[model samples]
Target chain A: MSFPPLLEDLIRSLKVLPGVGAKSAQRMAFSLLEGDRLGGQKLAKTLAKAVDGIQHCTSCRNYTQSELCDICANPRRELNGEICVVATPSDVAAIEQTGHFQGRYFVLMGLLSPLDGIGPDELGLDRLANLMATTEVKELILATNPTVEGEATAHYIAEIAQQHNVRVSRIAQGVPVGGELEMVDGKTLGHAFSGRKTL
Target chain B: MSFPPLLEDLIRSLKVLPGVGAKSAQRMAFSLLEGDRLGGQKLAKTLAKAVDGIQHCTSCRNYTQSELCDICANPRRELNGEICVVATPSDVAAIEQTGHFQGRYFVLMGLLSPLDGIGPDELGLDRLANLMATTEVKELILATNPTVEGEATAHYIAEIAQQHNVRVSRIAQGVPVGGELEMVDGKTLGHAFSGRKTL
Candidate 1:
């Protein structure tokens, strides 16, 4: 059955969400309209507030309402001049969830994809360079993904940090923790063997 | 890093959507706030409009912005005295997609689940009674799901329609059209054999 104009519009708008196709968008729209009208209202308000209020952190490029994100604003995070650079805010959250990284983060917001018109400027590489030059940076941790673009972006960032005499380290690329050696890919296994440490 | 208040609230509210967990909600929030602010505003307006505008169709209990849904309002749909009774609006959409059934539909909105406090009143069986009393309904097609609750709901609806001298017919239940003989379960195989059609 054909839906009303507003509902059709709503379904179409819902499709803007990543991974939501026509069928999923219809389901979500119907579920919200039928089962959870209040929840739908809350989502609407939140969406409006987020779009209107949230902005990029001046220092790290992470999403925030203020000029600086919580991490950048916190004095505790500035204790050491160590920074972990990542491709997305989700990666920052993943690292934060582990409660392991104490230093601040520099979010690239995206990888350096020249084909997609996303270059070092798109990734705010100049801002990263400025941070490295101004701060008493001790180490730069390259925590981007292990994809080809990730590797290239890491190399580019490393070059910038090296020019400024900042030590650079990359997150290990090998068999994952608790991964079976037999199931490891040939390239990963080769890297694991080559990067092996003395017992 | 802790998200700002608005971003955090947006992420939490996003979890209200079906299948969205904390991480997915966070990702959605960030994507909207960072990448698609205008899309986010559009979604918000559409969501609010949908929630405020859509209502149940007075005749079939299907979702619509007006008193009568498209099917009920259409003159072509009222040519026959046949009504397909199903549980939800999705079922109506599924039936409509096939384009086989030309008759109107009566959406129960939900099946009979006494455990969940959904009884005859909740399914609007009285409204079905009212429709039978007023309309020239000749046949009441029980097109509910083939589950145990569906069977019970169908039977209950059938009894009500039978009392009004309306013929009751059920959609066939057996091995699916494309199902393999070996893969078919015992009950379905039995039904398939029992309900075999003449050549």
Candidate 2:
């Protein structure tokens, strides 16, 4: 039996999802057209809404709809004299899930990759500097990954923090080569970041 | 550092992506905030464009940019006694990828799972029945998966075709139990659907 043209388009577009190639897209398309209309509608609606509604936290560069994120706005987090620097808010949640760190986070959003023309400005190093200058934060923990890029980024930030009389430390051993914060486990992250040696 | 409310909402909202949990959402938020304004803008644009531009093919229920899907519109697909039935257009593409199954397709979209309240209408069986009545199809191959529900659906279609005086057959064996069409190798699918046994 032959169908009209409208059905084929929906099946093809589903291929855009990660790990979903042509075959999987067909399954998803069939499943949606056959089973999950609400799921499909929700996927379409929320994808757009999330993209449009979300923006970077001005202070830490975390995604936020309002002025501050949940961790940044919490008054209890302010009492801690430290700010954990990371490459993403996902890093923040990874740390927070452990229930170990009392301090809030300052997400770097990205690393300083000079080769890629990404500098301190692009990585929001100036934001960290501004925060150190204004706030009473004592320890600045660099929780970026252990990649060459991450190490270079940590060192770059450490040099700048030293200027503001801030104690800087990077996460120590535990992260494997080419590992990302998202892949690292919570228990290991606490050990790595807490046992960080002087950069 | 404390962030604003809107910023938090943005980060939190991103957690809803297919695999993105709270932490991943935060990471994405931070990534955007830290740098990669270009990447962020591109991601936003991609998401927006995909959602708005992608539509279902009227014929096969697959993803398409226009009214008719590429396969349905192609003149080459309209050769004699042609019309392969599948659960999705992905199946059509899979069969096409093998350079076999020269006939066009009718995507069943899904099996009839009455336990889930999915009947013929839900699976588009009625449209398929109507299609077979008018089309000059010489053979109808049931290319649905080998699942219990899929078998049941195949049986129901067989009965419907008997009433319509159409020659229908199920795809042949060698497909693993509970295996979906997308999971099987290309050669296997070509062999299985082509060698389908008559019900």
Candidate 3:
């Protein structure tokens, strides 16, 4: 005996969310149905609007309702001639929070994974190349994650930057500020030691 | 600097799901926006339908699109004249999965928490009482959680059962079938000792 059809559908549909499984989906469905019908309605409306309206930014491949994302549309952000290339839009949000980088961004949206059929074309490397070649961008910062695919994606984009005669650099990988040295992973500790700076 | 307006709205909306915080919401939003727009649209449609269509079963208080839930609508389930009272619809599902009890259910939807303003009316105890007074229900099984509020609710419902001259029984509280004696909590162990029966 399963749940009523509508409740079961809600639970099954909720599993579309990342990291949500059968149990979590059922809990979410029950919670919404039991108490937060208004919140559930609002979420449904917002999700529908977002799914229908949001599109990739024409220039940077980031999600946006408009043709260009807010960051790409801003003229002042382009003054530095520096373009940061990252794997996803959330990466852009993270960098923006730092308030240090004053340049534009190029969101790859994904990395190169041959086994999964994700390659340069899937990452929109051609768009990133065109942006670099057409614009007077002075530097390209590779800020993908520390994963193997991220490194490969960064290297592939570095080659594109080299072809465009744009100076390319990678973000520093080291021990995080609040992270204890002993708790740091071997690869990160290795990077920290190799990339040590003089005081 | 934040995410695009639509993306931000989606993230905020996703936080309505239980256990989803800002970070998890952001990840869910990105996952949907990045690759699962079809899934997102389906979820939105299903969620909207569920929020608008799903309502309580008039008899059992379980979620259903129609007037009566499947179990309550079936004639065979009422043969034994046994009705199990539970705190939530999920509890009904749990009892149904066991297949041991061939009876109908009364869903309280919540425990009796006076501090939270949840009392008899909130749990629809009057409806339960009406059912008991009118129907041929011979026994009412209390299957609420083992928490304090659950016990209080069970006792409260037991009083109603007594008033209606219906037999009342509380599910046994003891160490689980596979639970280690040392790992069992003191309260459960004490109940296990007091409620011990001949093998």
Top of the candidates by TM-score: 3
- The candidate 3 chain A region of ten consecutive residues with least summed lDDT is A1-10
Interface root mean square deviation per prediction:
1.7, 6.6, 1.1
Q: Which residues of candidate 3, in runs, are more than 4 Å off? A: A178-193, A196-199, B178-186
Runs of candidate 2 with Cα error greater than 4 angstroms are A1-34, A68-80, A97-104, A112-118, A146-152, A169-199, B1-82, B95-104, B112-137, B145-156, B169-199
Per-candidate TM vs. native?
0.89, 0.62, 0.93
Candidate 2 local Cα displacement, residue A197, angstroms: 14
Query: What TM-score results for chain B in every one of the models?
Result: 0.94, 0.73, 0.96
Q: Give the true-contact fraction for every prediction, in order.
A: 0.74, 0.05, 0.88
DockQ metric for all predictions: 0.61, 0.15, 0.77
Of 1 and 2, the candidate ranking higher by TM-score: 1
lDDT of 3 by residue, B1-199 (tens): 4677878888888999999999999989988987799999999999999999999999999999999999999999988799999998888888889989999999999999999999999999999999998899989999999999999999999999999999999999999999899999999999999999999
Model 1: CA > 4 A from native = A97-100, A172-199, B174-186
How well is each residue in A1-199 modelled by candidate 1, as lDDT tens digits?
A: 5667888899899988888899888889878976799999999998897898888899999887889998999888888678999998889888999998899999999998999999999999999999988987889999999989999999999999999999999998789999999999999999998899898
Model 1 chain B lDDT-worst window of ten: B26-35
lDDT of 2 by residue, A1-199 (tens): 2223334454444444444465555555455544445555545444445546667667777767767777778778877888998886557767887787888788776777878888888878888899999988979988888778988888888898999989988766666678998989997788678776786
Give the winner by DockQ: 3
Which candidate comes out best when scored by lDDT?
A: 3
